[model samples]
Target: METFLGVDYATLWFLVIGGLFTGYAILDGFDLGAGAWHLFLNTEKDRRIALNAIGPVWDGNEVWLVIAGGALFAGFPVVYATVFSAMYVPFMLFLTSLIFRAISIEFRSKEPMRWWRQSWDVAYSLSSVLLALLLGIVLGNVLQGMPIGENFEYVGNWLEFLNPYAFMVGVCTLGLFMMHGAIYLIMKTEGRLFLHLSALVQKAIIFFIVSFVITSVYTLIYFPHLSDRFKESPALFAVPLAAFLSIANIPRLITKKKYGLSFVFSSITVSMLLIMVAIELYPAIIMSTFDAAYTITVHNGSASEKTLGIMLLMAAIGAPLVAFYTGFVYKTFRGKVQMDENSY
Candidate 1:
């Protein structure tokens, strides 16, 4: 129970792990979103523009996922073991989508045949959509709570994950990513494609807003505990307030033709939403459906103090390097995408 300025090592590591996953969601989210939009573009050039828009950064963006997974394993091995064991089916599907996403990007242009390109397009779009939905579904189930029995093992069958709330959350997540991806694409294209994306951006905003409102209403009705923190401490209300404003800013920015700002707002929207989730679940990383005593909190789920301290030191070095690298990549690739011989 080593304390850093009154906060225990476990809490500190919880913040670190949360930061990593939030980074993953914001970074890789748009790329996945972009991939999900592949089939919507009309022409070969438009499709290529969509593909190459994310080309320079998709792989690098995905590095965040790897880091997040490793950080989860390192910081909360028990949580990882329990959750992953329960989520093997969805996890496998997620992995499969990721593989197809990568291959779709790589193999799309390797041949000139119409059927080959079309097949890969379907693979790419479907996988990207599936990946986003699956991520959401997993998050939804995790939030709803797990049935842990005997030595912290998940006792429920996989079908239990297909509950209505989880599926609604999945749809909401897909809508959010689609909106996010469309905004990113707007920042990287112009003329006819921009017009196409411009039209799509407005629609995406509506789609996301509708999904978010429904989900929020559902949570308020069925999951009242999530809002307890904000109700108990009015100051913590700023997280949701900030999230609401960020979400509101997107459509406004888009109307003003400020796509870069719109994209920034989209990223902020994602980060703020996740922050709200962290606030809601603070301490309890996973809640037990069967009984309150079985809840897994930051205090109960962290690694050894020595292990955490050493890992924190390593993370101190590594996290900034990753941030700097991510920033440099975005900076170098700034502005609208233009295809070249090396483009995806």
Candidate 2:
């Protein structure tokens, strides 16, 4: 057994970051996906149902983002600084979108005007789209490698990060989340809205699968470095393979009216994608476009053993508490969502 202090710092950091990502994907994923159903819901009643489907859970779901960022800052300061500084603009945009999303949800109930409600809905949905795309672009940049100088700082300009590969990844991420939200809507609501969400989910899944394949091939070809990793460790493919299988089962699960199962599979797909990226970037918390040796490793990026030990202890306690609270909220809000005429 590895002692907490003796464990590879890089591995531990990876585990922390990975856990946060997985939790976020499973929790925020449905809420984001629920936003996708916003477009399909025509009636005011149906829209309210869509909103309430995620209302109880969306705010709580965002806690994972905080956890993920906190883990990065504490466990992998180098990575946190490098990625955030290099991707500052996009990160800001992403953050702004999240802010709008929160504000929209909060103020949505304060007004009964049609325009006010509609504006909030647009803000919520648009924010979802931007957040999804930003996440994808960040992943794409990581997989493709960043331009880090001798001092381990990002040397590339903002525009340099906006390549075709990154753009495709953004699209893929957006489509996947939309599909995820659709599945959640199907599971959480009933009536015409539920059926409409189901159909939308199916379509979104089809788009996601097709785009994912194309982007995968493009990523492999353009980023031969990533392909080399796969060649050295063929097991890495298992992540995507698992994702593919889960995605394939989504429709079947939905057809049987297994909404929870369908959402589970969709969440699995996102989790597998995160695992795949983490695997591809192993040992290098921040890769350098100039030279692999310039890349930041776990050992180099980590805090002191004392700091990590303290973090581990806190995580052991806090992580479970967060999980318990999250689970409690979800359980408390389970079952079909109904929206009254005056509902927020």
What is the TM-score of candidate 1?
0.98
Q: In candidate 2, what are the lDDT values of residues 102-220, reduced to their tens digit?
A: 89878977878989989888888888888888888988888788998876788888878798898899889888888888887877777777777777877887888888989988977
Output the worst ten-in-a-row residue range by lDDT, candidate 1. Answer: 143-152
Cα RMSDs, all models: 0.9, 2.0
Instruction: Identify the candidate with maximal TM-score.
Output: 1
Q: For model 2, what is the C-alpha lDDT against the true structure? A: 0.82
Give the alpha carbon lDDT tens digit for every residue of 1-344 in model 1.
Answer: 69888988888898998898888888888988888888999788899989988888899988989988998899998899989998899999999999999999999999989899999999999999999999999999877788987667888998788888888899888888999999999889989899998998788889889999999899899999888888889999999999999998899999999888898999999999999988888878888887778878887777899999999899999999999999999899898888788875
Q: By lDDT, who's the top model here?
A: 1
- The local lDDT score (0 to 100) that residue 7 gets in candidate 1 is 86
Q: What lDDT score belongs to each candidate, Candidate 1 first?
A: 0.89, 0.82
